[model samples]
Target: MTVRILVVDDSPFMRKSLQKMLEEAPDLKVVATARDGIDALEKLEEHKPDLVTLDIEMPRMDGLTCLRKIMATHPLPVLMVSSLTQEGAQATLDALSLGALDFIPKESSFATMSIMQIQQDLQEKVRRLAASPRFHPRPPAEPPAVRPARPAVPSVPISAVPIPAGTALPASPTAELLVIGSSTGGPKALQDILPALPADLPVPCLIVQHMPSTFTRPFADRLDGLCQVHVKEAEQGEPLKAGTVYIAPGGIHMLYGARGPKGCVELTPEPVSSLHRPSVDVLFQSVADHYRGQVLATILTGMGADGAKGMEQLKRKGAHTLAESEESCVVYGMPRAAVERGCVDLVAPLPDIAGHLRRHFRL
Candidate 1:
């Protein structure tokens, strides 16, 4: 089936370039091109394309404003065209929280070293998003009268995990370390689950969310302000500590190493052949080797099979494992792989994951 798309950008060259590149795909077609958000909105009514590729910086109405308006009015899958700079990363994340499906980085040097890679990546994301049956638009948000509010994730209380009277608790909670991996739709999913964790969490949490180097620090800061548990980008040689969430920085692999008696973050550039630099498999395998059965691992919404092998190893070591159910996943690729590999112990919807964690760790 042909997936009709609307390409919105202020640059005439970019619009033409994107249009030409996208139409090269047999199943993809650019139905309309808009100069800016206003033109895009008008085109929306005229063409009603299956998807939209929106530029973040535009005149009259910016991409974020357009996104808010789109969610409020016509709601559909929107992919952001973002720069690879720090500011671009922040806006891309904001777009994701506001309901964009995914993003393709727009670099100034695109025509030089990365054109083919970008084209392939963009086309793939467009196809995957267009084919998803479970895409849900967020509740209508009016264009913010002021700066947008940080997502106010409701914290999960200890009482929320109901234990029936006389029910035997595990002799000991199975995990001492918590590791999570995701991609595609991870930021919003992590926002939902991480904030629910109490400040007194007994285990240190490690996360690998496929992202660029410019984005990881901002993403961690964004989560830090909203979550009770402290969140920060993982640093080289930083000792692991309970009650903190350490996000693996992009562009490098995060592994575990013993610094005297404590486990510390070890950033490396080895395994240069991995599909992703900060690969979920790398981190999960490190944890499986170091902590073994004393780990709680989860694979959330994503678009690849990166975490499956590592999760399988974790399961063999008796680690407790969970996956976000298909109904709650935006892409369901990573978790589905783990489940199919016979690694996942439980599959629950996104909202219930934190509760399950709390119950397992007896938080």
Candidate 2:
């Protein structure tokens, strides 16, 4: 079936460029175009496009407000197109929280960039969103009944302080940097893990969760509110410090870089590498290059094999690599690929991954 899409943006040039890129795909059709969110909503009713390419900064109603309205009413898949700046990053995050499926960063120069690059990304994103299950908002279900508690494991110190109860304590020689990569099901999975980390974790963390712009900041804020550790969207040249986690902003790739003695994080808006912004491969390879033996790389639930080669690189560099066991992943593609490539040193269930980290640090 041909996938129908609505192109929504205030910039006439952007709308034209996007429409042109998307229509080039034989199976994809641009059914309509809207200059702003209000117009898009009206067109949404008339055209009922299967997908929407929305811009964050539009007049007469911003993209995020429209996104919330869509989720609350129409519930169709919406993809945000944003700039690669701090404001754009934050707005993208807000849009995700409002239910945008994904996003793309506006190319700085249509003239300089190759059409192939635009076509490839636009096609992939639309294909993925088209394939995605429709959004269904249901009233919250009651929490599952609590089960009997298991006997607690003995506590250990990862640093100067004793680890908190329920937290996985890394054994001596604990990792100085924890690197994580995830895609589908990542936001929810992160909700599970980040809050469980002790507030006094000894190491800083870097994460690459495949998502579009306007999503990561909200994810970070959600984690920050739930976890004791400070969580923030990564900024270029930001120092990797203990008790904090840096999430790679959507619509860009984040990589580890050197800043004097300590490692730092950098975000790039260069063309998509390995089929994704915040690509797992980009982050993992950089971690392997910079931190090498001291890094603990975890491949979480995601689609595709983006992280497999990077995990291999990490393993060869003597870093400890962990893959989420298939039984626990929302989609087992990434970790499974890593395991098959013989790059993963260990496979652990999601709930037990923290425990594994603790044990690996132990002598």
RMSD of each: 11.1, 10.6
| Model 2 poorest ten-residue lDDT run | 161-170
Clashing pairs in 1: none
lDDT of 1 by residue, 262-283 (tens): 4889899989999998999999
Ten residues in sequence with the least summed lDDT for candidate 1: 161-170
User: TM-scores across all candidates?
Assistant: 0.88, 0.63
Model 2, 146-262: lDDT tens per residue?
Answer: 999999999895644211223333343457788899986566567667777777777888889986566677678777988888999999988888879999998788998877456
Q: Pick the candidate with the highest lDDT.
A: 1
| Model 2 collision count | 7
